[model samples]
Every structure is written in structure tokens, then in C-alpha cells.
Target chain A: MTPVLIVENLIKTYPAFRLGPVSFKVEAGSIMGFIGRNGAGKTTTLKSILNIAHPDSGSIRYFGQELPGNERAIKQRVGFAGGAVDYYPRKKIADMIAVTRSFYDNWDDEAYRKYMDIFSIDPQKSPRELSEGMKVKLNLVIALSHKAELLILDEPTSGLDPISREELLEIFTALKERGVAILFSTHITSDLDKCADHITYIKKGEIVASDTMESFITGHSIRGEGRNLEEIMLHYEKEDYREKFAE
Target chain B: MKNLLNKELRLSSHLLSYLFLFFSIMALIPGYPILVSAFFVCFGLFQTFQNGRETNDILYSALLPIDKKDVVKARYIFVCLIQIIAFILMAVLTALRMTFFANATPYANNAMMNSNPVFLAWTLLIFALFNTLFVGLFYKTAYKFGKPFIAFIVASMLTICVAEVSHHLPGLEFLNTSDRLPLQFMLMFFALVIFVFATIISCRIAQRNFDLLDL
Candidate 1:
């Protein structure tokens, strides 16, 4: 089956930093967890995939169609939410939704209401009135309302309580069951252990590994199925610190 | 593009920007430069950009399905709409001064720039300069506005001074009189051309700069 998203040898450069020749794939009915330390070019890679940050050279396709010429049409079927998007703190949530809804033709008002209820977001309140977890939930509500086939979320579980993180993980699992492809980036590997079918690990703007979660743990010679993502991340990151100390 | 404009108006625009449209009425005052009315209108539009930056409008819009160029285009259109609205009001006030208030002693003995087509032309020129300096420079970073706005203030104050000083110059006295209809229309036409041409150039530059921007 064709993957929901394919990014090939993507590269973007800055005066002091560079991201890529990074590549990854996200298949339908699956959740791909993108893990990287801060400033490891995770956000840049995500933005490049969305073309929010222009790439110097690469190929990005969604549903087997190139993103360049078919941006609006393809994006109509995709939803992105995270740090890059912020509400007008003074504007009501309903007002923000109205503006966002105007851009998508497939918006489902009933689905929006259902998510709002599940998330406990009050449309009358502004973003300033919500907690960090509530804000993430609100972002999820907007994404789900449009019946998005693919959801690209950045750090949705960051700054959330453990229970809230579990609830959000459940939502990702439910969405995957419904065949919605998800690509989320975060440093919290525990959340991935619960929901991610596949894991893509990045360090210093390079993909160190990309595979099924179980295989990733065993393939690293960690020697047990019971071993988890956090242990694996720690095992690799420790080597990074050793290399830095040696340098 | 329409959806983008609607988003700007509904989300990014500040209420004070709309209320400031009333500043165009300043044209009715005698012994005043009157061109300052146009400056206040542009200042009102400045608030919209300010609100956009505070709310992360650029990143939010980039998240949508539209091209980045369309985002820049929508803002240009919004600025033009506000400017055109103010221009229309100022034009009406100028007409009132030329007709019913033409014989009023305050205007007749006024030492300042009078309300005439020349004044309208200068107003358009001010708008043009603002678009060229303020809006064009803004897209270079798409984040900072204070420096670009300061440049616009300096340029506009000079423009207003020049317009006021023209009436005091020996051969340029006709610019303040209502009787020089043919010349005033010509000046207005020339200023209109500058307004359109400068704005188009500014938009093109803004689009290119914004396209090069990362966010």
C-alpha cells in the first residue's frame, strides 16, 4: 500500500545550521513517532515536509502526489497543528474555528462538536483561558473536524500531565484504528511506547534509525522485548554525550 | 485568496483600525495641513499588521492550504481597501470645501495647505510612500515591524512638509487655490499613477521577500 507521506533526501540550510538529507515514510492506519533532541532539526524537517519552510532540494509527496503543484488540494485532505500555530489570545475559540473552517470544504460540524465535548473545550473562551493540555486538545479537535486523512502534529503531548498524555495517546490509537495516518514529533518516548507502531529517530539532523518499535529495540542489541523506547533513546543519547566529551 | 482576506479581517484586524477610519474627516478643518488625515488612516492600518505579528498570523496562514504568496497578496488588498475607503471620505470632504464651504473666511484666509485636488494627490502619494517603505520593508523579515514603521514615519513627515511648503513657494501658489482646476486634476492624475505604480512594485517586492522567508 502507498504510504500517506514520503519525504526523500530533503535538505534545508541556514547560516549556522543545516537540516537533512532526512527521509521518512508514514503509512496509513499507522502512527509514526519522530523522536529527536532539541535543535536536532525535528521542527525544520516537519516544516519542510509541509513546505512551511522551503527546501533547497528534495521530493515530498502525499497520497502518491507531489506537494508542489497539488498543495491546496492535497492539504485539503491533511491537517497540521502544533507550536507553529497560535490562537489570537483575545479571540474566542469559536471565532478561531470559524476562520479555520472557512478554509476546508470537508469540515464536519458534528465531528467538531463531538471532539469539543470530549476535549472539554469551551468555544466561548479564548486560548489564554485554556491550559497547555487543553490547547493541544483544541488543536486535535480542529484537525479531526476536517476529517483529515493525515495529521501532522508537533509536540502535542509536551507540557501535559501524565493522565492527559495518556488520554491523547488513546486518541491517536483511536484515529489509527479509523485508518488516519499520524506523524507526531516529540522527545517523550514513553508516549511512543504506548501508541507508536513505527519509530524514526533523528540525531544531529540525521535519521539514526527507522523501523517498527519492537524491531528497533531488539535490533539495537538491547536484548529483550520487554525493554522500552526510553531505554533505547537513553542508550543512544549517552553515546552522543561520550562523543561530545571526547571532542 | 478570499478566504485569506476574510481571515485577516476577522482575526488579525484590530477594532481601533476600523474606528480610525473616521480620521479622514480631519480634511474639513481650516488652517491645517489636512494631509495628516491620510497619515492617521495609514497608522490605523498599521495596527492590523501589529495584531498579525502578535497572533502569529503568518505561521497560522502558512499552515493553511494556500500558497505563501497569497498570504502577502491578501494583506496588500486589505491595506488598499482601508486606504481607498479613507480616500473616498477625504474626497467628499474636499468637495464640500469646494462647494458649500468655498466662501468660508476661515479657508479663504488660511495660511496652511487648502483642501483641493492637490491635497488629494498628496494624500495618495503619502499612501504610496507608506506602501513602498513600510509594507515592502516589512516582508523582508515577516516578523519585525518597528524599524520599517519608523522609516515610513520619517518619509511621510517629509512628504507632508513638502506638500505644505509647496503652497508657500513663489510659483507653486496655485496648488492651494480651488480655481486651478485643470492643473489640479493633472497633479491628482499623476499622483494616482504614482500610487498605483508604487503599490504594485511594493506588492511584488513584498511577495518575493516573503517567499524567500523561512516562516
Candidate 2:
């Protein structure tokens, strides 16, 4: 079977930075973790694959076809969630469902209702009234409501509490069990530990490593000490981030 | 193309039709002929522009399996649809005012508010046609060059003014004056034919832009 998502030498150029010379692939029915620091091109690659950001070079194929800009057939099979999924600030969750359902053929009302119940979401609350975790959950509920074959998640778990994140992980695990593919990119490593089968790690617009998640955790160690992941990984990345944040 | 038009309609809250209707009422009031017409054209374009910004989730839209041509086609159709409805309502209102203005109100027949129906119809048609034409061009241009928002609005306004002005020029009055069925029918038919051909060419141009679009 063809891979669900594939990018080859994708390049996005700007005067200050370039996002690629990057290639990666994710097979159907598997979860791939895209690991990179902030501004390390994780979102850029996602944007290129989805045709949100036009690539200066290279190609992205989704399920064996070229990703067309603003095409409906490719969008039909793909579900996307990110901070970019935000909507009218005053819109209620119920209003969101009512509006979004008309856009996609795959919208499952039953599934959407179920997810809302699972999250205990207030149907009447405006989007702005929701906590950050609730907003993320709301985003996921809409993405999952449609029977999308591939879910492209960018920092999906960033705002959730541990319990909510665990719930999301369980949902991802269930989606994988159903043979859906997932491309999840985040700064959080623990989120990848649960469901990711593949890993694509990038640094400064280049893919430094791509492999099975199991291998990455088992074989990699920086500093050869019991230093926490944040510290050890920072050293390996060879960048001092201390001054960017106050002690 | 039809499907995308339907999608744009839904995403924009089905407001263009209502906007056309609401602004048409302004025309029949007969106190502000040119003001009413300009209001409808300017406000309609502005509202449509806002709708574009609101529904501008192009990346999410790209997930669909359709081609870039169809995507651009749908957008152009939406712009045209909005302009057409606005022009039609404005034309009818102007005609009705010229017919019934004496019975309506104190301000009805004042030269400031009065207009010849034939002339009004032609002007409205041209304005509607060229306004849509400009939208197709500007949408593609705006996305491609990342032009500032204010500049895009200015360009659209300039085009609307030009198309309306073309209808009012001296020699063009013959096309506007025919009251006989065959002459009137032929004129309207030819205008529509030209409008449609222009739309098709505009669609093609927009599609080419989408093909190379940086977004």
C-alpha cells in the first residue's frame, strides 16, 4: 500500500530562514511523531504538505496523488488540527458543529456528539469561554468527528492537562487501532511515547533522524549522564536558550 | 464550480443575497439614486471581501481532492454571483422608481435621485460585470504578491468606478435606449453573452494563478 503521507526534499524559503531540504514519510495505520524545537520547521513541513505554505521546491504526495492546492478530494480524507484551527471567538461549540458539518461529506454527527459527551463540553459556552485544554479538545472533536483517514496534528496536546492529554492519547490509540494514520508534531516527548510507531526528528530545517520510535528512545542518549531530557537534548542541539527565559 | 459556489454561500452565511435585497430597497426610495447604487456596489464588495477573509482557510480547503482550477473557479463564481444579484436588484429598483416615483414621496422625482431606466440598467450591468472581473484578478494578485489589505480594496473600487463610467459615455447610449422587444432582447442577450465570456476568461486567469500560487 502507498504511504498515507510523503514529502520529498520539500523546501520553503524566506529571507531569514528556509524550512526544508526535508523528506519524510508516514505509512497508513501508524502514528509518526515529528520532533523538532520551536521554529525548527515542524509546522513549516506540515504547512507545505497541506499546501498551506507553498514550497519553493520538492513535492508532497498524499495517498499516491499530488497534493493539490485547495482541492476537495484530498481534503475529504485528511483531518487537521492545530492552533490554527481557531474560529470566531464568540462561537459556541454547538454553533461550530452546525457550521462545520456542511463542509465535509464525512462528518459523523453521532461521533461528534459522543466526543462532546466524553469531554463534558458545554454546548453553550463560547470558544473564548473555554479553557485552553477545552479548546484543544474542541478542535480534536471536530477533526475526529469526520471520518478522516489521516490526522495531521500540530502541537495538539500542548495545552491539555495530564488527564486530558491521557484521554487524547487514548483516543489516538483507538484511532490507530482502527487503522488510521497520524502525523503528530509537538515539543512534548512524552506524548510520543504512547502511540507513535515512527519518528521524524528535525533540526534547523533538516531531518536529522527518522526511524521507529522504539529505536529512538532505546538507542539515544546525550551527555551520557542522568540529565533530564530537556537539558540533555538542549546540549545535543548545542544552543543556549537560558537568556530567552528568565530564571 | 457549482459545489464551490455552494460552499462559499454556506461559509459566508448566505449573506450576499440578503445584502442585495437590503440594498435594493435603498434604490427604490428615490432620494439617493447614485448614492444608493454606489452604496450597494461598495458595501456589497466590502462585505464579500470580509467574507473572503473569514472563510480564507485555504489549507483546510486543499485537503479536498479537487484541482486548483475548480477551487479558483468556485471563488470567481461566488464573487460574480454576489455582483449579479446586487446589480439585478439595483436595476429593478431603478426601473420601478422611474415608473412609480411620482406616486411615492416628496424626494422621489428630484434630479439628484432620478435616473433613466435603460441607462441605469446598462450602468448597473457594467458595474456588476467589471466589479466581479476585478475581484477575480485581485484575489489572485493579492494572494500571489501578498499585497496589503487596503491596496486590494482600493484596486476593487477603482475598477467598479471604471466599469460604471463606461456605461455612461455618449456613444454607448444606443445600447441603453432601445425599447422595442427585438432590439432590447438582442442588446440584453449580447451583453449577457459577453459577460459570461468574460467570466470564463477570468476563471482561467485565476486558475493559472492558483496553479503557481505560493499558498
Candidate 3:
């Protein structure tokens, strides 16, 4: 199977943060877990992939074509969801869907409709009235409906509850089975445990770990007697475990 | 281009902007300071541009299958659409008012259609030239600063200032209206040429700036 995404030595530097000449590839139909601490450059890396942030150097290729600076052409086969899914409070879901579908030549109207049904999204309802969960669900519905070969989600489960999260994961599995590759970016390791095939760990603007999920989780573990998950993640994350692995 | 225009219209909220356009145009009856409303009506097209740039607005549009150049081109077209509409409304009012003072002999609406096709032609030529320069420069500037209000203010100030001067300043009191027509024509002709040249240059600058846009 061909790789759906191939990023080579990408770099983005700013006064406060920096990102790579990082390189990696995601095979079609595999779900790659993109994990990092809160400020670990996960979003920056994803933004680079989307062509939302221009890279300082290196290359990115999607479906074997070099990504141009133009978002219109590079983005059609890709469906993206992030904190970036901010919709106008008054915008009706139907209008957004129709407008969005008009832009993507490969969009699947049937799939989108199915997700709209599954998510219980009322097309007539204004997005402002929806709960955070409902909004996230709607964003997913939009992304899933597009028949995207490559899905790049930045913290897709941010505000989702367990039930909603599980349901979303189930849908992700279904899509993976249909040959869609997914880059699931999240800090929640629990989510990765369920859905990830490969994991890439980013730290301080560089990709510190890029390996299969089976190998990544094997490299570390969280053990605690009722400690907060965030605390444990911070504990190991602060120690630079990847350096130990290198040793 | 049509697809882009149609989609942009929808993005600006169908029926809403059109309503705004309707009311704005209605305010352009030239006799009673109504022509002043043309500026606010021009705001309709600019607002549409603004709506597209709101928080994640670019993210969604960036996902479309069209070219970015076409996307920018669509914005230029929308500006034209609004400008044409605003002019039509103002022209009609100007014609209607002119009729109030004219003879019983029937005459086609001169102000709206330009009784002298030369003036209409020249007016259209100059206005288009002015507008194209304004849009090309201001659109890219908007992208750079992402501040529509400032860009709007600057473009509005420049266009109104220039247009006002051209409208009132080209004729001298020392010369007869008939004799000075040639001199006025020359002034208008030079203005038209400069405006066209400026617009072309502005569009070129816009193209290059977008290539290096931080986003």
C-alpha cells in the first residue's frame, strides 16, 4: 500500500517555539497516534501538514504530489478538524455543509449525511446553540463525510465524554477499515491505547519518537495509585524518557 | 469564476447581504445627499470579504478544490458586482432627479445611462480603474494585516478624496464651459490612464505578496 502522507525534514521556527526538519510517513489505512505534551509542537506539526503554516524548510507530499503553498488544491482529499473548527455562532449546519461540499470535488454526500444522522446533528440548528460535545461531533461529521483519504485531527476528543469518545473511536475504526489513514493528535494516552496503530511523540519542536504503537507504549508505562493522569504524563514527559531509550 | 462567485455569495449569507445591498442602494438618490450612502453600500462588498476572513473562515475555504489565485480573483469579482450595483442605483436616482427639472420632450435617463455615451464610457472607465486599484491593493493589504477596518478606511478615504476632486476640480472658472471642454477632457483622459495603470500595478503587487503571505 502507498503511503498517504510523506513528510520530509519539515521545519518551522518562531521566537517562542520551533518545529522540525522532521520526517515520517503514514501508510494508507493505518491510524497514527500523534502524542505530545500540551506545548510539544503537535499542533504546529499538524498545521504544517495542512499548509496553514508555511514551513521554513524541507518537504511534504500527500498522495505523491509535492504540496504547494496553495491550500485550495492540496486540501480537497484531506478533511481536517481541530480547535480550528470555529464556526460562526449563527451559521446553520446545513449551510456550512453545502458550502463545504461545494469546495471538495471528492466529497461523499452520502457519508456526510450518514454521519449527520449518527451524530444526531440537526441541519437546521445554529451551531451556537450546540454544546461543545455536539459541536465537536458536528465537526467530525463534516470531516468523516468528505470521504477523505487522509484525516488530520488535532485533539479531536478535547471536550468529548467517554460515551461520545468511544463512539467516535468506533467510527474511526470503521474508516480505517475502509482504507483511510488517520493522524490522531492528542495528549490523552488512553485514547491512543484504543485506536492507534503507530505513535509519534513530539517534544520541544522536534519529533522525539516515531514508531509503531506496540513499540511506543512498550517503551513506557503509567503506574499510579489514584494519581491524576495528567500528573503521570507530566512526570515521565518531563524526564525525557526518549533520551534514556537512546542510551 | 461563476462557481466561486456563487459560493462566495452563499458564504456571505444569502439573502442578508442582498437585503443590505437593497437598502444601501435605496439610500443613493443623489439630490438629497443620498449619494453619500454609496460609501456604506460599498461596505457590503467589504463586509463579505471580512466575513470570509473571520477566525477559521480561511481554514474552510482553504480546503476547497479551487486555486488560491481564483479565490482572490473571486473577491475582486465580488467587489465589481457590488460596485456595479451601487452605481446603477445611484445613476437611476440621478436620472429621476434630472427628469424633475427637464423639458416635456422625452430623453433617455442621461445620468443613469449617461446622455453622452462618452461621459458614461469615460466615467465607467475611470471608476473601474479606480476601483480595481483600490481592491487589488486593499485586498492584499487586508490579507497582510488582516485588518479590514483599517484597510477599508484607507481605501475609502483615498477613493472618495480622489473621486471628489476629479468630479469638481477639472474645470476652471476663467474659461467658458464650451471652450474648456477640451481641457477638461484632457484632464479626465490623463486621470483615466493613470487609474488603469495603477490598477494593473496593484494586482501585480497583490499576486507577489500572497505568494509570501505568512499564512
Question: Per-candidate DockQ versus the true complex?
Answer: 0.74, 0.30, 0.38
lDDT of 2 by residue, B98-189 (tens): 46663555443343433445434444455444445454555464343224334544654564455345545787534323234366556556
| A236: Cα error in model 3, Å | 5.0
What global local distance difference test value does model 3 have? 0.64
Q: Which stretch of 10 consecutive residues in model 2 chain B shows the poorest summed lDDT?
A: B141-150
lDDT of 3 by residue, A38-134 (tens): 8888888887887657789988888888887545555777877774366665777787777767666777888888888877889999888787667
Ranking by TM-score: 1, 3, 2
Leading candidate by lDDT:
1
Candidate 2 ranges beyond 4 A from true positions: A64-73, A88-107, A122-129, A161-163, A222-232, A241-247, B1-3, B14-17, B29-39, B54-56, B102-109, B121-134, B141-198
Q: Write the per-residue lDDT of candidate 1 for residues B166-209, one digit (tens) a residue.
A: 88999989999988899999999999999999999899999999
lDDT of 2 by residue, A1-247 (tens): 9998888999888888888799889899999999878889998888778775688889788888887543467777888777545554455567656767766788899999898898888888877787766777787777778878899899988867798788788888888988899999987877887778998888888887788875665556542522333443464475456865654
Q: What is the interface RMSD of each candidate, in Å?
A: 1.4, 3.7, 2.6
Candidate 2 achieves a global lDDT of: 0.66
Candidate 3 docking class: acceptable
**Top DockQ: which candidate number?**
1
